[model samples]
Every structure is written in C-alpha cells, then in structure tokens.
Target: MSKESRKFHVPDALANLYDFANTLDLRHFTHHGIQHQQADELHNLAALGEWMRQHGLIERAAAPSQKTFEAALRLRAAVRDYLKCEPAERHRKPAVIGPLNAAMEAFALRVATIGKDGFALRPVTSDAQAGLSAIVAELYDAASAGTLGRLKMCAADECQRVFFDRSKPGTRRWCQSTLCGNREKTRTYRERHRHDPASEV
Candidate 1:
C-alpha cells in the first residue's frame, strides 16, 4: 500500500486522530491510485465510526454492523459538505456541524466502549476510555472555537486530498511533500529548464 493508503489507518492517539481527520479530505476516497471497492469504502467508514465511539462522541446505534458502516459514510459526507461551505452558510444550516459533530461523538463513544486493541467492538479499558474522551473533548473544543487551524486542500492538480498545514508558517501546499510537492517541483524544474536552457548550467 502507498503512504497515503496507510495514513487512513487508526492513529496511535487522539491528537493524531484529530490531525489525521482534518488532513484527510474524505471527498476523495481514492488514495495513491487505489480505487476503493465497496468493501474498502465500508472499512474506511467503519474505522471512522470506531474512532468516534472511542472518543465518547456518539452512542452505538441499533445493530452495529456493515450497515452502520454505510450510515457512517452518509454522516461523513454531510460533515464534508458542512466544512466545504461558507462559515455563514454552515451556521445557517443547523443540520450541518451540529448533527455531524453529534454523529462523530456518538461514534467515538461506541468505539471507546468496544476497546482500542483492534477494529472489532469489545470491552474497553479505563485508560482507553479516558484517552478517547480526551480526544473527543479537544476536537469539539477546536471546532466550537473555530480554532481548528489551517485545514488545507491539496495543491496537486489531479489530487483533492486535504491536510492540516502544520508547518512553521502554516503555509504548506501539498498533502505530502514527498509525493505531490516533489511532483510539482520536478514539473517546475523541467518547465524552467526547457524555457531557459542557460539556467540548467
């Protein structure tokens, strides 16, 4: 799997999850040339749902199964839409952030109850629950205060990946510097050299 593909895996900690979620643009399900099959997509949704439950953000809905995975996708899409829209419009639409956050929180709670050893739902430990709760709290705080920081869209022409710009300047332009950034730099270098051969020396 590509580096981008690996990024979607459950993070090691709550802070990492928040950073990962913001950095990822769920609108583009495909990563690193891998088109998601239905099962693959479901897995992604399930993972997010699990993360949500762990964070104490949401309660388990009836029948937590693949169907729940599907529901999570819908919720994910709604959240994406909310983030994509203008702040004023998002506020005007009560169904946006409020519902989305609730869903996320509920999902986190359920996942927390299920434990954190793996994706499967099982009993959670106190430490796990506390960690998840902390993550959820921090995420909500950031969202409420509009201090989530610079959530960025990818600069690659064909890639719509989003990421958190955590650079010193908070002006990062690519989802992954080794990938999209390098590609852009190479392209610019080639173009410049082609246009002005003297500069190559």
Candidate 2:
C-alpha cells in the first residue's frame, strides 16, 4: 500500500489498484492563491521502476523497459477513463471498457495458492513488468468481491482524481466533498443567481 492509500483509509486489497490508477495527477485548479501542478509519477522507465519498488511490487534492481513503461501508462489511462463513467453504466460503454481490456493484455496473471481464501491471482512472469500484472490481479479480485464499483473518478473537470467512494449508498460524486464538491455547488449557485435582478448590487 502506498502512503496516499493509507492516508485515505483505502482497503488493503484495493490499495495497489488505487495507487496505480492515481499515478497521474490531473488537478489544475487553484486554491487559496496556489495553483496545483499536474504530475505523472511514471514519467519514464526509471521512475516506473522506482514506483514499483516503493510499493514492493518489484525488486530493488528491476529495471523496466521502454515498452513496459508505455504499457503502464496506457493501463493507467484506460483505468482513469473507465472510472470516469458511472458505475452502473460502465459496462454499457464499450468505448470506455474496450481500451482497458486491450491495455490489460500486455500483462498475464495466474492462480496462486495463497491468501485467506487459499487462492489468489498472481503475475505469471518473473520480470519487472510482472508488477503490472499484480495490479491487474488486484483489479480482478476487487471486481469479484464487488468492491471495484466503489473506485470512482472525481466529477470536477479541473480535478479528475480517482477516489474510493465510501458512502452508504455508494453515490458520492466528488473525491473531496469539502473541496471539489463545494466548488461545484458554489459555481452552480452563482450561475443560477447571476441573472436574478434581486441579487444585483
């Protein structure tokens, strides 16, 4: 589990998937006179290797190839796209689901005898790229356990951050209600009252 996942109280089983999906931060909104900077943690093969190592998904010396790095980026993009859709409508949208299915083809996973259930999914390869497959396994497990639907992308266009929905009804829209959600509400309120004569100064 990464620091961000732990800080957010993400479930251990979905921690890796959560972290992998958040590799690219697309927040461009300014708050409190400070502009947020966009960042891609997997900027290159070296950075990818370091990220995997930090998450214990790869060895200290495992160097990812250029191809693997590209694949990782594609996977992240596909995941973000999928999360952008409504959970109930996700399956109905092939345009969003197809890319993720294609990106997952680069990595292979196999049944491993482990975990409390006496079985778990694991990567088949012995290379550093195998770490990517571990991420796939996490996705598969979460989906089967019916928890994958909770993973969602923020509705704020300026902050398309992926977040786990912990609401009882599982219908939360924004990642942070106090920030993104409030921003959206405030914007809507201003737009609604903009033409009202009674509100003119």
Best by lDDT: 2
Tens digits of per-residue lDDT, candidate 2, 46-144, equal 889999999998999788899999999999999889989998999999998899999999999889888676998888899988988998988889889
Best by TM-score: 2
lDDT of 2: 0.92
Give the whole-model CA lDDT for all candidates, comma-separated: 0.50, 0.92
lDDT of 1 by residue, 1-201 (tens): 124434643223324433334434334334588863332222564565555554443465512445455545555455455544443356677767677666555344333333466432323333323333444454454565554444445666555454555577666777788877887898898988898968868
Structural similarity to truth (TM-score) of each candidate = 0.42, 0.96
lDDT of 2 at 196: 88
* Stretches > 4 Å off in candidate 1: 1-67, 80-140, 157-159, 188-201
What local lDDT score does residue 38 receive in model 2, on the 0 to 100 scale?
100
Residue runs of model 2 more than 4 Å from their true location after superposition: 115-117
- In Å, residue 80's CA in model 1 sits off its true spot by 4.1
